[model samples]
Target chain A: MLYLGYCRHCGAGLLGLRRCGQGHLLVLCDECDALWQTSDLGQPPQFPPQPDLPCPHCGQSLNGPTAHWASLDEVRQAGWNDALIVGPGGCSAASAT
Target chain B: MRPGRRSVGLTLLGFGVLLAWLVVKPMLPTGPVETGQVRPETPNAGPPASVERPDGAAEQAERPVERPIDSAAGALTELPGDVWRSPGGLLYGPGSREGHRLRHVLRHARDDPDRPGEHGVFDGDQAAIVALIDEAYARSEQGAGRVERDGPRSVVTVDLQRRVGYVGGQVGRRQGHPATRHVRLVLEGRNVITAYPLRP
Candidate 1:
């Protein structure tokens, strides 16, 4: 868990942050789940890690700046809703809930 | 003054009392755990000890005796056939922790990410625990949540309990189920293969 200082949303001291199902960095107050949303990504990337995945839309391997998949907001802003965003296959979560 | 007036007045009084009780109930929390729900005890936190035992000839015997019979022998056999018999949860590997924590964090009345192959890498047991969780929530198409691997093995420790028990990091749906579903698959270690049900 990377220390990200205080949560901007809750003002609670943040010891860490994680990506929620929606691809948002969910800042957690783990004891009580006073969740905070932050735009500032923290401590670079570590843990299970950001995969070197390909964009289902561009059909090209994600590299350099595009390593992580774009959020729904970014996708929409780019007018790429119709693009086929691929799951993180191989490392993709198989249990599709 | 009339008989009908008295009857109506009594009915109104009862309704007022019922409404007042509803507003008051929120303030009266009996304890942290709800009344009907079972309270999950933190394995470490139990009866408070008033004083530390004095070091003496008695300490040797007392310490050994104080330890639970099941735990003292944990090092000998980590994956016993019936692990459910133990009271405390085991330490799960990073992989299993990610697998279990992933779903519990994601699946909600929110954006539903589909969990696939939950049975494979999802938390359950050091052996085939992921396969078990997957089978339980095999209906991944439900758009509940996703399961991801954090390490090589499903490292969650499990304890034998009546309620769903946590394996390394996730709970196994297999230990007990009125209905059981099994699937055949090839996993990490070829020597450690087994058919785990979709649900316990």
Candidate 2:
């Protein structure tokens, strides 16, 4: 899977960034469906976190056990190789240069 | 004038009149002409207008002419199979990273890492999975599913309420993952990010 990081709470969950219709950048967990809002791409969660958005997969409350942001560096430290970049057109492979 | 000369003159006059009529006949409007109706400059310029054919049948001018499905050589005129092609070449050939994304999603068709025993698995082959994704995308385009934005990508989630595949993942194998009635597909833009069975 092309992932940005692994969920800190649930070690098995794969974490990726998703944008909501209102232009909110949300950190999402594929395994647990947890969610966290962030103001910037690949950055930590914003302070005074926004209200929890519904999980896109299950349509349930996104505030699960692993509802926190994990930066790219932390993801690399965790040994998840081939991490994708959060760009204007969603996740993409880093340029060779 | 002499009689013969007079007869020749009358005959000449008759021929002249016939020639005049031939030239003027085309200039004169034939049949009932509609005063305000203007002919379209282009074939598809306006709405369909009913026009009488030489066989006296009224046909819509806007209707496109139908063509035969087979060629004169008895070969199919169109290519076989679905017209849509995977932009990343996952299904066709010359594979790319998109294939990896597809495989990751298909993994759930066999096993759910989080809730291994509880979730079901998809039953069909890669083609079936791709077809389901295509259908979900169609429905999503028609506003049948939930649509969200992930960066510049569009994330569409569609729930197909039918038995798409049987349970056969790592955990479901012990229980003999039976046919599931509902399936959910998560698509990023036109690519299917992931798809798996959901408990009904």
Top candidate on TM-score is 2
- Least well predicted 10-residue stretch by lDDT in candidate 2 chain B: B90-99
Per-candidate TM-score against the hidden true structure: 0.20, 0.34
Q: Chain B, candidate 1: TM?
A: 0.23
Q: Per-residue lDDT of A1-97 in model 2, one digit per residue for the tens?
A: 2245555432334555443332234566554334555323345322111123444444433333232233344434444443354321234433421
Residue B149's lDDT in candidate 2: 61
**B23-97 per-residue lDDT for model 1 (tens digits):** 999898675542222222123243222111211111122111121112232221233331221112222111111
Query: What CAPRI-style quality would you assign to candidate 1?
Result: incorrect
**Candidate 2 local lDDT, B131-167, one digit each (tens):** 5666666776687866656443344556676677665
lDDT of 1: 0.27
Q: Indicate the docking level reached by candidate 2.
A: incorrect
